[model samples]
Target: MKDILSVKARLGLGFGSLFLLVLIISAISIFSLSDANNRFFRYVDGIGKRKELSSELLLAAQQRAVSARNLVLINSSTVRVDEKNIVNNAHRKVGELLRELTASVEAMSPGEERVEAQRLISDIQQIESLYGPVALNIVDLALNGDKDAAVVKINNDCEPLLRKLVEVVTKFIALEEQTSAANVMHSQDEYELQRNQLIAFCLVAAIIALALTLVITRGLDRALGTEPSILSGIAQRIASGDIRAIDEIKTARPGSVLASFGQMQASLSALISEVHNSSNVISGSAQELSAATEQTRMGVSQQRLEIDQVATAIHEMAATVMEVAHNSESAANAAATADQQAQTGGVTAKQAVAQIEHLATEVSNTSQAMLRLKQESEHIEGVLNVIKSVADQTNLLALNAAIEAARAGEAGRGFAVVADEVRNLARHTQGATQEIETLIASLRNISEDAVERMEVCRGLTDKAVLQISDTDVSVTAITTMISNIQEMVRQIATAGEEQSAVAEEISRSVTRVRDISDQSAASSEHTAASSMSLAKLGGTLKQQLERFQI
Candidate 1:
C-alpha cells in the first residue's frame, strides 16, 4: 500500500496532538490549583482551631485564679479550718494551668504570647504566702454560713490580679487569629490567578486546532484531485504527435507532485513526435535516390556520343597525309629520266660544229682563184691591139719618103736631099715590126700563170661544203630526244592520282571505328555518376534511421 501521509495530513495530525496536550496540561494545572485551595483552607482551619483552644484554656485559668484569691481572704480573718490544705489545693490548680499555657504557646501558629501567661502565674505565686492562712479561714466561713462577708472579702483582695490574668489570655488569642487570617488571604490570591490562566489557555488551544483543521482539509482535497489532471486533453494531444503541448505544460504553475507528472507526460509526447519526423525524412531520401539514379544513366549515354565525334576527326587527318606522300614519289622518278637524255644530246651537237668550220675554209680559197683569171685576160687583149697599129704605121712612112726624093732631082740644087729621105724611110719600117713582136710574147706568159692559180682555189671550196651539211643533221636529232622525255613524266603523274583516291576510302572506315570506341567510354562515365548518387542516398537514409532508440 502507498503511504498516503501527504504534507497537509501530517500538519493536521500535529495540530490535533498539540490541542490535546495543551488541554491535558490545563486540566493538570486546574487539579493542582484545587488541591492548593484545599490545603490553604485546611491550614486556616487548623490555625482557627488552635486559637479557639487557647481562648478556652485562658478563660478556665482566670476562673480558677479568682476562686483561689477568695479562699485566701476568708482564711486571713480566722484560722479555724485546715489553712495549709486549702492553700495547697489552690497552688496545685494554678501551677498546672501555667504549664498548659507554656505548651499551647509553643504549639500554636506564631504563638509567642504564652510569656504573658507565665508572668500572670508568677504574680499569683507572690500573693500565696500572704494569703494562704486567709484562704483557709475563707473556706471555714463558707462552710459555717456567713456568705456575705466571704463574698465581700474575695472581690476586694483578687480584683486587680484577675484583670492581669484576662489581659495575658487575650494576647494569645489575638496572635493566633492574626496568623490564620494572613494564610487565608495568600492562598485565595494564588487560586484566583491559576483559574484565570486555565480559562485563557483553553480558549487559545481550541482556536488553533480549528484553524489548522480547516487549512489541512482544503489542501488535501486539492492534492487528491491532481492524478486525473496529469492525463488531461492536452496530454492526449501530445501523445498523438503534437509538438506544441510542451509549451502549454511549461506555462502551467503546478503546485503538487501531480503537476510534475503532467510535465513528464509532455516530454514523452515530444519524444514520440521527433521519432515520426525522422521516419518521414528517411522516406523522402529513398525517393530522391531513385530519381537521381535515372538522371545519371541518361548523362552517361550523351557523353559517349561526344567522345566518338572527337576520335573520328583525328583518323581522317592521318589518311590525307599518306595520299600526298605517294604523289611526290612518282613525280621525282619521271624528272630524273628526262634530265639524263638532255645531257647526251648536248655532246653530239658539239662534234657536228667542228666539221662545219673545216668546210667553210675550202669555199673561201675557190673564190680567190676566179678573181685572178679575169685580171690576166684583160692584160693580153690590150697588148695585141698595140702590135697591129705599129705594123701599119711603118709601111705608110716608107712610101711617103720615096715620093719626096724623086721630086727634088729635076731641080739641080737639091739632088742631095732626095737621097737622104730614102735611107730614113727604110730604118723606121724595121723598128716598128720589132716593137709589136715583143708586146705579144709578154701577154701570153701572164694568161697561162692566172689559169694555174684558179685550179688550186676550186679544190679548197669543195671540202668546206661537206663539213657544214654534217653539223646541221646532228642539231635536229638532239631536239627530238628532249621532247620524248617530257611526255613520259606527264603519264606517270596521272597514275599517282588513282592511288590517292584508294587511300581516302580506307580513312573513312577508320573514322567510323573511332566513333564507336568513344561512345563506349561515355557510357562508362554515366554508370559511375549513377553509382555515386546511390551512395549519397544510402548515407542520408542511415542518418535518418539513427533517431529511434529501439
Candidate 2:
C-alpha cells in the first residue's frame, strides 16, 4: 500500500484525515455544550422552582385552615373581622400557587414524567377547590356568631378536605423531588459521556497525527534511500570527478535514490578513469603536435619576413618597370615615326630638334621627380613597416592553415596539405601586403610631386639649344637612339608582367590562408591558438568556456 501511493498522495491523505477528525471533534463539542446548557436551564427554571411553589401552596392552605378556626373561636366582631381577612389572603395565596403550578406542568415536555407530574398537580387542584370554599364557609359561619355551627363544619367538612388537599400537595412535592433528582442524574450522565467522548477523540487524533508523521517520514526515507544531505554530497562528489566514496552509497535500501546513485557512481568511476587515461595519452600527442605547430609558426614567420622584403623590392622593381614600359611604348611609336619623318625634308629635321628639345625637358622633369621621390623617401620606412605588419599577418594565416590541419579535432590528416599550402604561400610572397594606408600616402605624395614635375617639364633646357642644329647630322643619331629605347621598353614590360603574376599568386595564397584560419576557428574553437596566430596576422581572437561547479 505504501508503494502503491505516491509521496504526494500519501501526504494529502494524512492531512485530510487529520482535518476530518478535527471537524468531527469540533461538531461534537458544539452539540454537547449546547445540549448540556439547555438541560441546566430546564432543571433550574422548571423542576426545582415548581417544587418550591407547591410547598408554598401547602403552607398557605394550612394557614387558611388555622385562620378559619380562629374566626370560630373569637367572639369580638373586630377580631372575627381580622380572622376573616387573614383567611381570604391565605385562600388567594393558595389559588395563585396552584395557577403557577398548573401552567408549569402544562409547559413541560410531553412524556411519562410530565403526565405523572400533571396528574399529581390536578389532584392537588381538586383538593384545593373543595377545601378552599369549605374553609371560607366556616369563616362565614364564625362571622355570623354561630360558633357551634362553625365548629361542626370544621370537624366534618374542613378537616377531611384539608387533609386530602395536604396529602395531594405532598404527593406533588414528592413527584417534583423525584423528577429533580432524575434530571440531576441525567445531567451528570450527559456531562460524563461528552467529556469521555472528547478525551477519547483527542487521544485518537494525537495517535493518528503521530502515525501520519511516522508513515510519511518512513516513506520519504525509503524513496531517497538516504538523507537529503547525504544524497547532495554524493551528487557533488560525482560532479567533481571524485568517485572514491561510490561504495558508501551501496548500503542504501534497494530501489532507493541512493541506490541508484551508487550504480551511477560506479559507472561514472569507470568512465572517468578511462577518460583520465585517454587524456594522458592525448596530452603527449598534443605536446608533440604543439611542438610541430611551433616549428611551423616560426618557419612561416621567417618566410613572411623574407617575403615582405621581397615584395618591397618587387614594388620598387615594378615601379621602375612600369616607368620603362611607358617610355618604351612611347619610344616604339617615335621610332616608327623616325623612319617615316626621315623620308620628309628639313621640316622633319626641325621636328627632330624639337623632339630633342622635348626630351631635354622630360629629363629636367625626371630630375625634379627624382628630387621629390627623395623627399617622400622619409615616409617609405613607415610604409615598409606597414608592409612588414601585413607580411606578419600573412605568415600567421599560413601558420593557421597548419594549425587547422593539426587541431582539426581528429587525426592530423590535413597536416601535409597545410604544409603544401604554406609552401605555396611562400612561393607567392612576391605580392603586396594590405598596403591601403601606406599606398594612399605614397600616392598622395607622388601625385603632388608629379604635378610639380609637370610644371617643371613645361620649360625647355638651355643646354638643348644650339647643339643639335644640323638636321642631317642628328637624324641618324636620333634613329639609332629611338631603336635602342624601343628594345629597352620591351624588356621592362616583360618584367612588369612577371611581377604582376607574382603579386596575383601571393593574393591567392593569402586568401587560402584566411579561409583556413576561419576553418580552424569554427571547428576546434581554438581561440587561444587563433589569438596567438593572429598576432602575425594583425587580428585578435578570444576564448571562453562555460562555468559548471557540479
Candidate 3:
C-alpha cells in the first residue's frame, strides 16, 4: 500500500470503493421495493378477489331461495309463470357464481387455504343442487293448485338448506379475509428483513470507505514529507534574503523539492563573492590614476606662469627696438641733407680757390674767406661730436636688450638673434662716427694750413684749394655710412616685432594647456570619489551576502 505513492492511484482507489458502496445500496433498495410491490399485488389479486366472488355467490343463493318461495305462493297463471322464470334465472346465476368461486380457489389458494375454499365451494354447490329440484317441485305443486303444500315443503327443507349455504359462504368470506390479513403480515415481515439487511450493508460500506480514505491519506503524507506550513515558512525566509535557513531545512524524505533550492543558493553565493572582489580591484586602480593626474596638472600650471613672463619681456623689447628704429630714420634723413650741403660747400670752395688764383690783386678778399672757412670747420667738428654721442647711446640700448633676451631662455631665442643683429649695427655706427671725427680734424687742419699759406704767399692758394676738395670727399663717405647704419636698425625693429608675436602665441598655447590640465585634475578627482563609493558599496554588498550560509 505504501508502495502506491502515485497520487492518481490513491485517488482512484478511494473513489472506486465509494462507487462500489453506492452500487450495493442501490441494488438492495431495488430488491426491497420489488418484493414489497409483489406482496401488495398478491393481496389484491388472490385473497381480495376470492373474497369478492364468495360475497356474490351468497347473494345469488339468497335471491334463488326467495324466488322459489314466491313460486310456491302464487295462484294466478300469469303471476306463477313470472315467479318460476325468476327462480330459474336466480338458479343459473347461483351456479355460475359457484363455478367462478371454485376456479378462484384452485388458481389462487394453496395448502389449507385452498382446501377450505374448495370445501366451502362444494357446500354451496350442494345447496344449489338441492334448491333447484325443490324449486321445480314447488312450481309443479302450485300449477296443480296445491299451494299450501308447496309452501310447507319449502319452509321445512329448502329454508334450512339455504340458511346452511349462506353460513358456508359467510365462513368462506371470513377465511379469505383472514388469509388476506396473513399475507399482509407476511409481507411486512419480509420488508423488515430487507430493511435490516440494507442497513447492515450500508454500515459495512461506510466502514470500508472510511478505511480506504485513511490508507490513501497516509500514503500521500509519506510521499510529500513535509506539511504545507513548513514549506511556506522556508519560502518566506528565502524571499527575505535569509539564505541561512537552507541549512535548517531538514527533509523527512530523500529526493525532496528543497534540494533544488539549496543548489540555487550555492550558485548565487559564488557569483556575489566574485563581484565583490572585482569591485575592490577596480577601486584601487582608479585611485592610482587620479593621483597621477593631479601631479601632471601642477607641473603644467608652473610652465604657464613662466611663459607669461617671457611674453611680457618680449613685448617690452619690441617697443624699445621700435623707438630706436624711428631715431635711426631721422638720423638717416639728417645725414642725406648734410651730404647735399657738403657737395654745395665743395663747389663753393673750388670757386673761391679759383678766384684766389686768378686775382692776386684781391689779397684782402682771400684773407677774409680763409677766416670764414676756419670758422665753418669748427662748426662741422661740433656736429660730428653730437653724432658720436648718439651712436654711444644706441650701443648701450642694444646691449641692454641682448642681456634681457638672454635671460628669457628658450622662449626668447628668436628675440636674442634679433638683438645680436642690432648690437652689430650699433658697433658699426660707433666706428663710423669715430672715422667722421678723424676726417673733421684733418679737414680743420687743412683749412688752417691753407689760411696760413694764403697769408704767407699768394702763389700757395691753388694747393690749399686742392686739399679742401679731398676733405669734402671724405665727409660725403661718412654720411653714406650713417645711412646704412640707420637701415640696419629698422630691420632689427621688424625682427623684434615678429619675435614678440611668436612669444604671445606661445603664451596662449601655454594658457590653454593649463586650462586642460585643470579640467583633467577635476575629472580625476571625481573619478577617485566614484571609485571610493564603489568600494564602499562592494563592502556593503559582501556583508549583506554573508548572512547566507549556503
Candidate 4:
C-alpha cells in the first residue's frame, strides 16, 4: 500500500473499498433475484400449466359427454347439427388440452415430479381416447336419423365411457394439483436458501469493508501526523485566506508531515511581500492606463459618431440611386413601347402611301376615259347635222316632184299621191334630226365639264400620293430615332443599376466599418474597466497578504 498523503485520497480509497463491497453485495442480490425469478417462471410454465391443462381436459371431457347426449335427444335437424358441432368441438378441445398437458409435463425438469406428471398425462390421454370415439359414434348415429339407435348407444357405450373418463380426468387433475403444490413449496425453499446466502455474503462484505476502513483511517492518521479535526481547521483557515495560520502550523508541527507546508508558507510570505510592493506600482500604472483608455474611448466615440453619419449618408445615397434605377427602368420600358408603336405607325404610313398612289393612278385613268367620252359626243353631233342636211334635200325633191305631177292631170294624180307621201316622210325625218342634235350638244358639254373635273382630281391625287410618300419617309426616320432612344434608355437603365449596386456595396462597407468602430469603442471602455478592476484586485491582494508574518 502506497502512503496516501492527501486526506481526500485516503478517504476516497476507504469509501471506494466500501463501494466495491456494496457492488459485490448487489451482484449477489441480483443473482439471487434472477434465480428466484427463474424458479417462479418454472412454476408458471411447468406445474402451473399442468394444473391448468388438466382442468381444461376434465372440463372438455364432461362437455363432450353432454354434447353427445344433446345429439341423441334433440330431434330437429338444425338442433341436431348444433349438438353435433358442439360434440366435435369439445372432442377437438380435449385433444388439444391433452397435447398441452403433455408438453407441460415434458418441459418440467426430470425428477419424481416429472414422472408423476407423465403418468397423469398418460391417464388423461387414455381417457380421451376411450371417450372421444364413443361420443363421436353416438353423434354419428343421431345425425343419420337413427334417434332410437343413438339413445341405445349413448346408454350402452357413451355413459360408461364418460364415467370412466370422469374418474381418470379427476385423478389426473388431483395429481397436477398435488404436483403444483409441491413445486410451490420447492420454490419457497429455493428463495429462502438464496436469501440466507445473500444475508451471509452481505455480513462478510460488511466485515471486510469495516476492516478496510479501519486500516485506511489508521494509515491516514499516520501520514497526516495530526488529528483530522486539526487538519480540517488548518485547511479551513487556509481556504479563508488566513495566512497567519501558517505560522501557528509551522510552530506546532516543525518536523511533522506539515514540513512541506512550512516551505510553502515561506514561499507564500515572499510572494506576498513582492505582491505588496507590486500593488503600489500597479496602482500608479493602472491610473495612468485608465486615463489613457478613457481618452481613447472618447476619441473612438467621436469617430463612431462621424462614421455613423457618413454611413447614414451613404445609405441615403444608395436609396436615391435605387430610386433612380427604378425610374430609369420605367423610362426604358416606356421608350421601348414608344419605339414599337412608332415602327407600327411607320409601316401603316407606307401602306397608306401605296394606297394613295394606286388611287392617283385610278383617278388619271378616269380623266382619260372622260376625255374620250367628250370626243365621241362631238362626233355624234356632226352625224346629226349631216342627217338634217339629207332630210332638207329629200323635202325639196318631194316638193318638185309634186309640181311635175300637177302638170300631168290624172296621170299626175297617181304620181302626185306618191310625191305627197315622200314629202311627209322627209319632214318627219328633219324634226327627229333636230331633236337628236340638241340632245347631243347638251351631252357634249357635260362630257367636257366632267373631263376637266377629272383632270383636277387626278392632279390632286398625285399631290396626295407624293405627300403620303414624304410622310412615310418621316415616320420611318422617327421610328429609327425612337429605336435609338430606346437603346440609349436601356443603356442608361443598365448604368443606373450598376451604380446602384456599387452604392449598395459602398453602403455595406460603411456599415461594417461603423460596426468595427463601435466594437473598438466598446472594447476601449471594457479595457478601462478591466484596468480599474485589476488595480482594486492588487490592493485586495496586498491586504490579504498583510495578515501573514514574514
lDDT of 4 by residue, 445-478 (tens): 7676767767676766766676676666667666
**Order of all candidates by lDDT, from best down to worst?**
2, 4, 3, 1
lDDT of each: 0.54, 0.72, 0.71, 0.72
TM-score attained by model 2: 0.41
Clashes of 4: 0
Structure candidate 3, residue pairs in collision: none
Q: How far is candidate 2 from the true structure (C-alpha RMSD, Å)?
A: 59.3
- What is the lDDT for 77 in model 4? 69
Q: Give a tens-digit lDDT track for model 2, residues 277-318.
A: 443333333443454465456556655665675576567657
Candidate 1 positional error at 105, Å: 5.4
Q: Pick the TM-score winner.
A: 4
In candidate 2, list every pair of residues with a backbone clash: 392-536, 393-536, 393-537
Using TM-score as the measure, name the better of candidate 1 and candidate 2.
2
Better of 1 and 4 by lDDT: 4
Angstrom error at residue 449, model 2 = 99
What's model 3's overall lDDT? Answer: 0.71
On lDDT, the leading prediction is 2
How well does candidate 2 score on lDDT at residue 42? Answer: 76
